[model samples]
Target: METVKRVLVTPEAKKVIDQLSKQHGKLMFHQSGGCCDGSSPMCFKEGTFRIGSSDVRLGEIAGCPFYMSRSQFEYWKHTQLTVDVVKGRGASFSLEIPLGVRFVIRSRLFTEEEFARLEPIQNG
Candidate 1:
């Protein structure tokens, strides 16, 4: 069976991850659909932030687990999300704000073949 990835990290994003990991040890990501942060993906030191029951683990990017609210996941389930880094501080509390870059999500809808091979998501 083919393996379909739900989440991925661009090389630019991976470089940021490497830097973050060195400074913070381990990390994780959570997609912010709205609220104060807008739609930016927030990165945190693993275990520093709480994962609630309403969250769903989509997959990992750059070896860090990525999650989103279950409600948000419903809207994004049919798409593949790529973590990309962009210059400018987003309206997020993510660690990258201090570095003058923010992690953003770029998505592409999954083809029928890819959707069939997608990994399962875990409910938090």
Candidate 2:
């Protein structure tokens, strides 16, 4: 994928990434944005992030690794964030943060149909 911001995925997410890497040969990160808040870094199976035109670059967070678009990196530069995994019931990836920050949960990456449903909220 294109280079973007550098971000870190939590250790909980590492297990999933390890599995995905096995299945897909490897896994990388990619994040986008929401309207009201700053750009949200997310994980992508395999994608492109062009700097300048883009914003984020792939990197590590806390200790775990993730991808961030170039724009997102610059926008979120010097910002400290929390990343964790929430399981049980309908388990989800939670980007523990202050108001206005967001991250793409794992479920949304599965399909465009499902992603579209949440697009309004993410984009709004």
Candidate 3:
């Protein structure tokens, strides 16, 4: 069966990830839904942040696992998320802060065909 990817990383984002991994080692991503971070995807060193039971594994980007809270997933499940890099410092504690570039999400709704082929997400 054909598989559709739910998360993606742009080349610019990948370059930043490469830099971050060199300094921080393995990494993971969690999409923040407002509050302190204001809906930004935060990056952390793998195993540093706890994955809760209510989180869903959306996919991986730059070899790092990406997740979202179940509540956030409900709102975004129909879309494809592309991780992109942008200038300026974000308010979150994500690793990219020191590099003057912040990771951002660009999303678009999946087509009916793509949705049908999308891989299932796992509950954390």
lDDT of 2 by residue, 1-124 (tens): 2222223356675655565456555344444455543334444344332334444333454333454445554554444344444443222132222222234333212233432332111110
lDDT of 3 by residue, 6-121 (tens): 99999999999999999999999999889987888899999988999999999899999999999989999999999998999998899999899899999999999999999889
TM-score of candidate 2 on Cα atoms, chains taken together = 0.44
Superposed model 1: Cα runs more than 4 Å off: none
lDDT against true structure, model 1: 0.92
Stretches of model 3 off by over 4 angstroms after superposition: none
Q: Which is superior by lDDT, 1 or 2?
A: 1
Instruction: Work out the TM-score per prediction.
Output: 0.96, 0.44, 0.97
Candidate 1 is scored at a TM of 0.96
TM-score leaderboard ranking: 3, 1, 2
Flag the better candidate by TM-score, 2 or 3. Answer: 3
lDDT (Cα, 0-100) at 73 in candidate 2: 48
Which candidate leads the pack in TM-score? 3
Highest lDDT, which number? 3
Residue 64 error, candidate 3, Å = 0.4
- Tell me the lDDT of model 3 at 118: 98
